[model samples]
Target: MAVGVSGDDLMVRVGPDATDEVLGRPGARIFDMTGRPIRGWVVVAGSAVTEDEALGEWIDEGHAFAASLPPK
Candidate 1:
């Protein structure tokens, strides 16, 4: 995994395939496994899918990011 920060854009090299739920506000975009824009990229982290469900590693990383933060 790789993490890079530039301006207001964040980049994370997830994996070959990512099919997980991303949790975010209503304006967020959740990308599917094939890197397709499932939704708008709103906040830092948002579970793409429901909790407790098996999430793709990429989406998990996004959740982790939100969890790791120090709150708003």
Candidate 2:
């Protein structure tokens, strides 16, 4: 899943195992799939994220299918 910050233009996707820890931290707000505010989640980011980070985070399969045309 992806974590997005409120009023900040950044998002991070982490493994299922790290979801709770990441979103459970302070100073971060969790949003639902519809961009609605929720609770009980964590967040993590910064240069420490990695030597090189992608423009955005997304599931490989989700990205692949996003570019395809919808079925009639």
Candidate 3:
């Protein structure tokens, strides 16, 4: 994983072929460098997909990115 910081947003770069099983954790918006949203990027952390059914369908397709806070 590669991380870049742009102002107040955290830019993340994960493996291109990453699967849902690898990035099924919730955080914030998932999009590409071009600013296009990628569906299935907001999967629930655990098996509680039903609670967020819409987000559960997020597949780790294409390059994915998200905003994150710097480690404290």
Candidate 4:
């Protein structure tokens, strides 16, 4: 639920609160497989995540958001 991969892109579940902010980041975009974008989810370009720290930060954001949700 936190992180995924679509082709070379990195998918992250950052939740609604951080969606806007994350979208402004380099190579970040709304995850839009359907006609409309899926809120709280983002696709980060592989180029932007070439560094280990950058990749970790995004995954951490996703983990934080997922952790905030109520248990299933």
lDDT tens per residue, model 3, 1-72: 244444444334443444344454454345444567554332222332335452323322222333232545
Candidate whose lDDT is highest? 4
TM-score of each: 0.27, 0.31, 0.31, 0.95
Instruction: Compare candidates 1 and 4 on lDDT and give the better one.
Output: 4
Off by over 4 Å in 3: 33-72
Q: Backbone clash tally for model 3?
A: 2
Which consecutive 10 residues in model 4 have the weakest lDDT in total? Answer: 15-24
**Higher TM-score: candidate 1 or 4?**
4
Which 10 consecutive positions of candidate 2 have the poorest summed lDDT?
A: 53-62
Preferred candidate (lDDT higher): 1 or 2: 2
* C-alpha lDDT of all candidate models, in order: 0.39, 0.39, 0.39, 0.94
Candidate 4, residue 28: the lDDT equals 100
Over 1-72, each residue of candidate 2 has an lDDT whose tens digit, in order, gives 334443333344444344555464333334454676444333334432333333333333223333343555
Instruction: Please tell me which model should have the higher TM-score, number 3 or number 4.
Output: 4
